[model samples]
Target chain A: MTRLTRHDARRILDGRDRSGRLGALLDAAAASARPAELGGEDDVLTAFRAAPRHAVRPSRRFLARFVVVKAVIAVALLGGVALAASSSLTPGGEGSPGQPVAEGGRADPAPNTPTEPVETPTAPTPSPSDTSIKPFKGEDGEDPPEPGRPSGKRLKQLCRLFLDDPRGARAEKDYPGLEERAGSLERVRRFCERLLGEGGDDGDGKGEDPQDTNPSPKPSASHEDTSGPGGPHNGPQGHKGLSARSDGTYVG
Target chain B: MRPPPPETDTELSACVDAARSGDEDAFRALFRAVQPRLLRYLRVLVGADAEDVASETWLQIARDLRGFKGDFDGFRGWAATIGRHRALDHVRHQRRRPAAPVPDEDLTDLEAPSDTAAMAVDALSTDAALTLIASLPQDQAEAVLLRVVMGLDARSAGKVLGKRPGAVRTAAHRGLRRLAARLGPDADARPTDPMIPAGALTPRDAT
Candidate 1:
């Protein structure tokens, strides 16, 4: 039926619980958050011990998948070896029995040609964030021009491709606090991908507007509030503080 | 409370290392340090189901201890997260089976405090205090318990409640204000809260 302003309450309880009669209640409740003396610690410890060992044993699904992958590689290797042997045998049997091993290797190049196509199949794992584009893969698959040259759209495309390459992911794995950097880089990559009309494996990225282009929000988009307690304009910053704190909830 | 015994954070870190090596005493020290505050937070969150939820929480903590990657502060937040989840699940179960009676043995078995005169007074008032806390609105109760009781900074408490820190601060302030009101106008004059005086709450921020 009655109300107290937050300001009034803060001023009153500013120096709390000196004598200990009432302050004891909040303290006691806070302390109660700790483990009780019910000999429950032992039981808890026992239950914890019962959890699956924290050993880095790979999951069963990973193991099964690894086995399958290994099996496919083995079969491919065997097929290549068989093709190599038959090509060598035919070179000796048919055209020139006296021909050298290197030359004979290309005598009936059908098997060797087929093996090229087989090896190319390995490129199809379909990563969502793959950024490698073989623009110079005509025949020699030569590297593109060096980055020192400044130019038009080609340069920007190259930069985006380089940043988004899977090598960046491997490099990121080694750096301690690179996650934030990687996130921003990924955003840029996604932006570039959209610019080039490249469809991403990420499903939710397709948010309508095929031609309506939007810029990637920079990592520094968040405005950090330096104001400590409050001021006359304390109203707007009120909501942002709570949302910032909530970001830390899911600790690993 | 009592400035967290000065050596607490360092001692906790050391005990964690020793406990990971399977030292019983070290593990007990950790359990002693964390259990009280953890139980208090859970009590407010899930009421009588606090002990069961706490048991589940500790089990998860023990299992995950070896893989944990932060200081004592991080450990508290981590433990609190697990405890909050367990408490939520217990609350959900209670909702589905509202008529089911909570098993009473857990609360019946709590080891009483050794400091007779102070905690004896504390015991009675604290019980009354909990009753009063449970009567507060749910958000207010959680915000107050996390800030005033569990000693979490507003930001950390916000994470546990999945709220923003500003929201947590407002909620806590409102809850305390309401609690002051419920104490029948004399609560402020009744012993005010000092920063971690003698028993129970620890200022982990101190260490």
Candidate 2:
């Protein structure tokens, strides 16, 4: 017997079989419809009538799912953008102040001095300083004032008085303690000026006239001192000013 | 040995379109044309439960006919695909609740009903032929039934079976060769003999 090729099978399946025997066999095998098979025509027709005329089309279902999926994706993208924007903004705000504080804290040999400068700049009113003065005075009076290094309490007091009434404080009688802490009254005024600059506290605008006249040289000197290698004496005030300027630039 | 004339593609497509528009007679016409082939294919797949699965298949077809597209050939393939799915579902359902196994004798009797007195001989031969085809491997039996009984081409049969056209063709070829071998040489010896006459061999004349 010849082998049945795919082509012969295809021809026979398509009902164009040249060989009569295989075709006849297929015809006989395709049995006539029994009563049971045709009996369900009425039932199927009843189901057809019961089914909705137009419940839902497949394309319509697909389109609805597509829209819902797209909406979810769009909302997720917007949420991600909002979260990224807020996160990016917070780091910049924190890094501006934090970098200078970190640099100052890292470079300063005296960890205790850095906190004093941070507190002095934030105390814009005399009343807050007066409240803070009592604790310091009690703490410092126990340790007798050192000759070359004035106590922090005494320095803060002298700086406030000098800022309030510069002429009166400069007179040798009003703040004899400050003049005695230093060698002369001239040195006391210069010390107060350095303290105020380090504090960055020109907020009251009371005694800013003298400093404003020569402020350009001070900032340039401070900028040079800060930019140069390892000038820890002037670093705190320079760092504070530098951080405020950077914060302004970032916000704008 | 001749089968009845099958519906032409034009008439079948017309019936499908009209049935989609809720024409009852057209739907009945489509049911008459497709039900026998569907039942035959399902009998091979699910045995005695072919009628139940075919009913479920038609219900789904009736409900989803509005969503169907393509011509009459596509409609047949679509119906076959639905029938196959329902048959598989019935098999799975049976496996889940396997209370008692029906005997082979009862299954053969159920397939060839004795009540059809006029067509008893034809039904017996048809049942024997189907039983013989079903005894082959599952893929070969499906390939033969879909290709021959359902009158689907290899590609259409491939779509219904979820196989590639080449694989379907090869399977159908191997199945036909196996069936030919099983039928023996005497059945094939007179293929070109003039005893049957050439006019009777034509597909149109078979009707």
What local lDDT does model 2 show for residue A193?
58
Best lDDT among the predictions, by candidate number: 2
In model 1, how large is the Cα lDDT of residue A135? 9
C-alpha displacement of B134 in model 2, angstroms?
1.3
- lDDT by residue (B1-207, candidate 2, tens digit) is 354636677888788777766777777888888888888787777666677778877876776565454456666766787676556534433333345343343454454345756566666556556655664556777788887888777767775665666888888888888776665443544443212223222221121
Candidate 1 residues A1-252, lDDT tens each?
236566543332332442233344465554442213444877766745553353321233345345445545544554455466467764434443333233433333423333433222112221213211110011111112223333345434443443344223222222211212222222333444454445333322233422113323233222111011211112222222222212111100
Residue-level lDDT for A7 in candidate 2:
76
Per-candidate TM-scores read 0.48, 0.52
TM-score of chain A of 1: 0.21
What digit string (tens of lDDT, one per residue) describes model 1 on residues B67-163?
A: 4434454456556765765554354334333366444433333434545666554554455565455446666777777666555666666655556
What's the TM-score of chain A alone for every prediction? 0.21, 0.24
